[model samples]
Target: MNTNGLKVLLIDDTVMILQRLQSLLAEVKQVSRTESATSAEEALVLMDGYQPDVMVLDINMPGMGGIEMLRKLNVKQMIKPVVIMLTNNTFAGYRDECMRLGADYFLDKSRDFLMIPSIVEKVQERNVLQF
Candidate 1:
């Protein structure tokens, strides 16, 4: 893992949202690589090849939602990536469930989308400091 750069994986069913996030993260100096998956299954497959330092996941999708994916990750005890749940779901239940399931951060897609880059940058800075 490169402490200087963040390998970010974005999971969102909406192509526009994915593109927007990719474009936003591109401006951040700490982000070296970015990948997008429209589904949890696709994200899992992508993870096999590219282990991301941070993951931006959406709660609603065709199959295996973000919360369920977090549960699976917890059960498998996989490479414990820093998970940031970015979803349009505004329910407190969803937010609480995601946090309980191991989400490092939860943000509403409609209101907090712009915060992603700053959060990723902070995560990168923290990673660098840890070393």
Candidate 2:
């Protein structure tokens, strides 16, 4: 993948997590832009202007949770970006629900956070190969 300028949107309520993710994503060769939102509502608003190629989302938020957001996105047919649900919630139900709702990938924030960038890189490579 020529990851020269990939636009990535990260949605997480924790400021520290967001900052960490932003820094990690910045190091990826394919990542060019990184945007963040504290909640699903804020992410929705940001989406109007920034159509990210990839979205790293959290399952829990103040207003709309990641599952609800994914359902809404599916209903509206807004599934262009590869949605990766990154959350601390590791319940089977939550994982199953997210996958059914159109999340391309689901990762536990504590255990799988470090794997995100590599996953994104692989996704980018797959996308490039598809073309």
Candidate 3:
């Protein structure tokens, strides 16, 4: 996969969170496109039309939370996007659970929100080196 430009999918219940993350990622040259979904269910629907290279997900939602969505993605064998679980819940259980469920990165929304662009850039760099 060409990582020079990455397509990112942002899934969160909050509009502000989505907008903030989108704007932050927009500044990064590596990000070619971004799509946002207010819920995991909506994201799943969007996935049929868009295969993202990276997924920035929230752990908690009204229905079909991020963890459940991750399981569905694995079971369905969807295009394996690099999963980044970004949430305000920084509990150890959530972190471990997310990692076990195939999350590449688990970031605390409060402390790690600003690090997303750098993380995406690093993923792009790593993919470039892999090829």
Candidate 4:
């Protein structure tokens, strides 16, 4: 981890996915804090408080999917934290749309969960704070 005490917000609609991600990130020593949300609405509320440096989100949520949340976040002109999408949808169109909508990374849920740390690692290594 490039940052000594980085905080991350992990959001997903499923409890299982959230738990699995949390466990993967637990191995990294630099991540000092982790806040999670199961819905976009809940995540919005948490965002005002936690203000995480990085956000890993899942698209296709029940309500207020990842793209929707990004749209909402844009209105506030937030710091635009580095958002990595964890989704089952891997279509080229969806990935392109997410990038256009402010998502920095689009990853497959089935194969990318294990790479969370690596993604964060690269982001931290670049030292581009508040991406």
lDDT of each: 0.90, 0.88, 0.92, 0.84
lDDT of 1 at 89: 83
Task: Show where candidate 2 strays beyond 4 Å.
Answer: 1-4
Superposed on all Cα atoms, the candidates' RMSDs to the truth, in angstroms, are 2.0, 2.0, 2.3, 2.7
> TM-score per candidate, in order?
0.94, 0.93, 0.94, 0.89
State the RMSD for candidate 2. 2.0
Q: How many residue pairs clash in each candidate at the backbone level?
A: 0, 1, 0, 0
**TM-score: model 2 vs. ground truth:** 0.93
By lDDT, who's the top model here? 3
**Considering TM-score, which of the candidate structures 1 and 4 is the better prediction for this target?**
1
lDDT (C-alpha) at residue 116 in model 3: 95
Model 2 global lDDT (CA atoms, 0 to 1): 0.88
Per-residue lDDT over 1-131 for candidate 4, one digit per residue giving the tens place of the 0 to 100 score: 43566689998989988888889888876677789999989999998878887899988898789888988888884587889988999999889988998898899988776888988777666664655
Q: Which stretches of candidate 3 lie over 4 Å from their true place?
A: 1-4
Report the poorest 10 consecutive residues by lDDT, candidate 3: 1-10
Candidate with more favorable, higher TM-score: 2 or 3: 3
